[model samples]
Target: MKKRALLIIAGLFLLTSFPVTGGSAKVTQPPSQKEEIIYHIFQRSFFDSDGDGHGDLIGIRQKLDYLQQLGVTAILLTPLYESVYYHNYFATDFYKIDPRYGTMQDYLRLIKELHRRGMKFYMDMETQYVASDHIWFRDSYKNPQSRYSDYIIYTDKENTKPLQIVAGISDFKGYDGVTRKLVMVNLDNKEVQAYNYQLFKFWMDPNHDGKFDDGVDGFRLDHMMDNLDNLNRLPHLFTTFWNPLLGKLRNINPKIKIVAEQANWASFGMDYLKDTKIDRVFAFRLAFAIRNFNKAELIKVVDSTLIQTPKGKQQIVFIENHDMPRFSDAVKADPGKLKVGCALNLLIGGIPSIYYGQELGMQGSRQNFGITDANDIPDRQAFEWYKSDTGRGMAYWYKNGPWWQHNNNDVPNDGISLEEEQNNPQSLWNFYRTMIRLRKNNPVLIGGAYKNLINNNDHVFSFLRYEWGKKVLVAVNLSGDKQDVVIAMQSAKQIKNLYGIQPVISENNLAVSLPAYGVAVWAVK
Candidate 1:
């Protein structure tokens, strides 16, 4: 069955941007902030000034030029709170920045520099649990008579939970949610809900004003709807936690964006995420779309997702992210297919999220963070800084030891490095550059309604984006053999070439012959 969906753009101005007129002459104003890109800074491999081998905020500041060169306008840094382990999922404290990553002064400098460039900054917050080393935990553990003991939920009758592990690392030594050995407040507990609320309040209260600081505009919600035994299913948990958080944040900053980490399609949270209050949703479905699909098959997935997503919220699009296998690893490390996948991500709806090293074609299947053998951190190799030299000076900033090793052979020094792509116009870097520029040039592509063009085609996939009476068609050929596709358009003003396989002026029907792994973009006049 075909689903019809409509996306109404809000708080967005017309593309026919007018110049400011002061008295009589036209005056130039600052460019649109909406056009800026948001780069998710993993911070693990960003830069290391201290030579301690982990990326820190200072290192991130040093690499701002690289991000700016890529035309990125914002950086979504992972949690910087003090934690005992890597990834920092388990927070030891919410009030201060981790010393290993750098002092608060470094973070302030990063914000200052980014703001100077007219860019935005967002920090990740994990409201799940505190590490065993946290002051709250210490206080609760050391003093049984202290009032802080109420922060942790313990059981005198029975033990329902076991030892806790942060991000799959069992040695984290955290308060288990299921077992009561070290009591961690159960998310499902109604009595502890207030405590969780206070935790969030404490995390956002920078001035200790007991109020959230409005300077932070957005958040990268980590493991948002996971590990909820008593909280029930995804939809229920979202209503239980997300709605409240959204309400609280909106009461302060109405423009804040909430990006949740829940990826389940069948879950009700998927439907709830489309709420108008939630501005954007992370496109988790793309990770499952690997070498298993042809161009035609990929289109169906995109169509289904577009239909399911709420019209008001944007879908965060991407080909590869930190948690998933690298795009290069999907096509059996085929660089050509990687370009096609990335192109599709850029052309699709929502904000495009580029993972670290994806631009340079880093390769890995999965990773073992030295815990379980089957599940591991794959493709998370250190960045190769030199174009020809062996990795010598590349350093990471976090003092905590990394769970995984650099597994891939591709580095900055190799021929397949980012440096090579930047110089070569035909390289994948230019392809991304062109794609981003195309998205910006065509307002219809950004704020338009997405409609599937070809439903049952075997080798070709196509769709049309419509807005402001403008329509743009995007198609991709993922099959190994060449195939012709019949395009559907309402008018005779169809023009293809800016992002498509060939130039065509279709009067109702357009025929396109697509090569394997080829992507095309067309516009309607």
Candidate 2:
């Protein structure tokens, strides 16, 4: 299996894309603020700065030009607060910046640079859980008379042992091999609520100047939920916990957009939108259906999602993220299928979030390497910065760890690094660039309503993204064999080729012949 992958890697990958129109097309008005193409970065795995082997705020600041060139309007970073864990989930302190990732000054500078380029920055925050070393845990634990008592959930009347959220959960073993106890915070506590508001407000305007230039544009609520751990300890939190806190945050910064990672990935997230103040949620169903490559499943999920989502709210679409296996792994490294995934990511009608390193076909899977956090290290490896796998900007933070032996996918000369793909016009990275530019250039693709286009072929997925007086047809062949699909349409002869691939007009209907794993787009009146 490894030999076959190496052989495929040697050839590199080829994808066809042409400039909109024959060349130098007419300019159109840009899309609204609602159409932000978010580039989600696993901050630890992104580019390194200061030769620290760890990705830092200054490092991200240095790559602003590269991110802007890729056409992403905003960046969504993983939690940056102080945490012993490598992923920064079990934060020890919500107010302090992770020293390894850089200082608070570096964070402000990164946000400043992002806003200067007309880009937005979204900070990831999860406050429901904390490390055992946190002040609230340390000061309150086993101390019922302590002022910070009731800040953490304790089963005993004496307030000794904090309620364990994860089953059989003990001290969390960090990727660095250090163990720290994890605690579930008491969300129902009023003081905790007040502290949460203060923390959120502090990030909104860190300088306290009220100029808002240095603050993050919004936040990604990590593992947001109404019920705490389904233990029935904290229920109806949307009204009591979230809405009140979020409403207060909005009062401080009305424009602060919050996207929730709903606790249940299988849910449609209408409840989160309807019951809470969240602006958006990840469309996991659509993502799963897209990966499955089944026409019926895609249509079913998309249709249901579109119909159910309320006005003024949005669904974030992507093939994979920090928690799941890379899309390349899902398709077993098929270059064509990878391109298909990219096309759908931008061509659909939703806020598309391109995960960092996904553009270069980065590969990893969720490993069952025991209960320790190391199991997630496989999917969260360093971003491939060089084809040779060694460079100044390489964020290979896991190199010296025990998993170093298991950084099995980080092969030299595999042609999966940004260095190899950035310059190659036919590389997957360039394909991502082309698709992003395509979506940004076309107004209909941004904030457009989605409609499934009926096609005879099961291997092909067709949809129309339409707006007032502007309509675009996108057809993708998700299979390994060429496919011919007929779509019902009238006056289709005037179809304009907005992309390299297009179909012929048979009578009054549209006839599209897509090569194996090919994607095409056209403007149909």
Candidate 3:
């Protein structure tokens, strides 16, 4: 509150002609509406501290200072439960931490360190399916009289054949080169729902002392859907299964936030917001639109996304994620397009998420390796921490394997590693840092409402973010050439450049010039 006057005064009298702001007016937004900048890390691909090639919890703790300096408010990690798979998605033991990732003490220490620095930890939880070795499946696979028989979905009346998971199959080869059996859980059963609630609650308050210092702040629900991949087995899940379980978890920790990944990427996820009332959802359509670099597409997607979002909820915007292709490969490693992507990722009206290696412009695309989950390994490669692959903390857990043959993404001396770009001022790493800092310093950019602008040129994508009396305008050129566009003001008569090249006023119109793939932010007067 004390710095509000100085900030407002600094924003005014900014080398332009506009009405002066005075009197007792002030700007503020609701606490719930304030968004978070999250850094999404693949647990096994982040960094390794024990020389085990696989990334561990201790590695993440060691890098907390680096992450804190990057200005992200939170970190979202993939599932950490014990599993036989490389990605650790299918849990063999739901209650134990994966040995490859470290021990329970390591996980607890990571949470404590994260909370100690005011950073939240959002654990990725997927309780829908388990591997063949899970206790529920092992005991009840062919034994109908077992007490846990109803815990898993069985095909025949005798409980001999279990229903398949996502791909409608009983088995899938894991990254460990083992074709392990899999089974979908009977989510409709009340017992299964109760188990899920308990699992979620355990992560929220591990020690259960009423203090969450050792627990996660929230959960990232993976592959959350109503019908479980539209297999029609668990119908009306949002109303019958999810709502009841989520309500109980919220009751325990009222401040806890849950982020759901809507199974259908093409969907606007309005139902997830309106029905389940989740805190945030991934903006998949906008991520596709950003990669296309089409101004009309960007305008339409951004407008449609914001309109569909219910009040008090937000959309998480990003160019790529664990399942998506790296943005560097999508743009052919073009620096300008990368900068434009960074600007929109942070400045858009939503909570922003940055994939682990995205800041360094690392490249990887999903490959079709015929069979198995090896195809997605390129998208989840080890974080490039040095100019060369052989480094102390390099978490190349998939190296010296058949899958590594296809991963030409991590070429040496390619200027993609953090070590290569850490000192370069014009690198993508610096651009991301600058954009994050700008978004943090400006309150309007965090909680302001988005309004698309109608510029003259089709290559220019412009929007206005306004809260209370403060307004900020962002314009990005999506083309490969220079562009000039005029923004007609309805109320404010002038615009002052705050983050990029300055613009001039021509008969009440704010005409701005931009370089190829240039982005600028202005303080509207």
Which number leads on TM-score?
A: 3
Which whole-number lDDT from 0 to 100 does residue 386 have in model 1?
A: 54
- On lDDT, the candidate that comes out on top is 3
Cα lDDT tens digits, model 1, 1-525, are 222211112212122111112221111212232564677766766567677777778888888898877766677877888866556666677767878789877877777687777777777887556655666556666466645565554333222222343343324332111211222444555544665556555444444563333245577777665444333322365667567756876775566677776645334245546542566667666545534664434555666565566545567777776666778777876655776777777776657777766776767677444343223344444555557523443553321234334445433445566656788887776777787788788766665656666423455666676655566778777666676666554444547577656644444566677776778887766
**Best to worst by TM-score, what's the order?**
3, 2, 1
- In the range 1-525, model 3's lDDT, one tens digit per residue, is 122311222113223222222321122464235447899999799999999999989999999988877788899999899988888888998789999889999999999999888899999988889989899988997799988899998989788888878867788887677797888888888888888888888888889897989998988999999989788988789988889898998888888988999999998888899899488898999999999998777877897887567777878998989998899899998999999999999998788999998998888888876657788988898888888866888888888777898675458888888888989999999999999888876777888777766666778888877776677889899999998777655556667777889887665557788999999998887
Q: What is the lDDT of candidate 2?
A: 0.82
Q: What's the CA error at residue 358 for candidate 2, in Å?
A: 0.3
The model with the greater TM-score, 2 or 3, is: 3
User: Please, what are the lDDT tens digits per residue for candidate 2 over residues 1-525?
Assistant: 122321222113221122222221122333453458999998887988988889888889988888888889999999999988889898888998999889988898888888888899999999999998888888988789888888888889787778888565856777777788888988899989999988999999998888889998899998888887788888778989999999988988899999999989899899998989999999999899889997777877887776578877888999979999889999998999899999988888778999998888999887765668887777888888788988887888878767777674579989898888889999999999889878877877987777665555667777777665577889898799988777656555489898857677765567778899988899886
C-alpha root-mean-square deviation, each candidate? 8.2, 7.7, 6.5
The lDDT values for all models are 0.60, 0.82, 0.83
The pairs that clash in candidate 2 are: none
